[model samples]
Target: MKKLLLVLAALLVAACAHAPAQSAKEAGAKTERNFSPAHVKEVIVKGKTTQKEILAKIGTPNSVKRRSLGVTTGPAEVWNYWTAPPLNDVAKGGLQPVTSLAVVFDDNGVVQDYAAADSSVLIQ
Candidate 1:
């Protein structure tokens, strides 16, 4: 009876370990949906871009904020993108993936300084 109990306990531990790992992988895949680095680069690197052009190309940003032009901060426009958690696994702890792209426009409303948030979260 002792040996049988020990064997059963070992099997239960092994099964539990494998179960949690699959959940982690599923969480990671859920986060991957909203992240698109390629799309971000394409919009920023191109020459002579206007706000209207950016809107047309990438569609509407997730959010936007405006700032005044200054020495350290010449005109600021922030754009955000996000992906929600998967529907079936709502109980699991998963972050809503978010990326922000900031575009500073010159007086003429052309892109002056374009910056993107560090995408390390998505890469992992």
Candidate 2:
């Protein structure tokens, strides 16, 4: 049994070793890094954009949440994305405030509201 387990582990490691590496564009590893306070304004707009548009602008969200609230007049879908400087930029002695953006969509996937929280939680 121990030998079987070892063989399985070896196979797993070999499979992982052969997997293709992720490229920067495919990874979207903070390609739009080091956003200023005004950057969110330029990207996200409430009641005028759709979830599809947001995805196109921001690539992929870190998370997506959906809930059916009993309330009749609020968002039912939420998409979250985080912004921070790349390591190189951070090493240059610049301030990189980590910010989280939550975009809420109605039943129809149209953006209803959005909020950005900084290390200081700048609600706009």
**Cα displacement (Å) at residue 102, model 2:** 0.6
Worst 10 residues of 2 by lDDT: 85-94
Model 2 lDDT per residue over 1-124, tens place: 5434444554564444342456877666536542234666788677788877776666556667887557666568887766544434434433455677778898888888887777732211
Best by TM-score: 2
How many pairs of residues collide in model 2?
A: 0
Q: Per-residue alpha-carbon lDDT of model 1 for 57-110, expressed as tens digits?
A: 654455556665454555555554443333232333233343556566655667
TM-score of model 1 relative to the true fold? 0.46
What's the lDDT of the predicted structure labeled candidate 1?
Answer: 0.51
Best by lDDT: 2
How far is 21's C-alpha from truth in model 2 (Å)? Answer: 12
Pick out the ten consecutive residues of candidate 1 with the lowest summed lDDT. Answer: 84-93
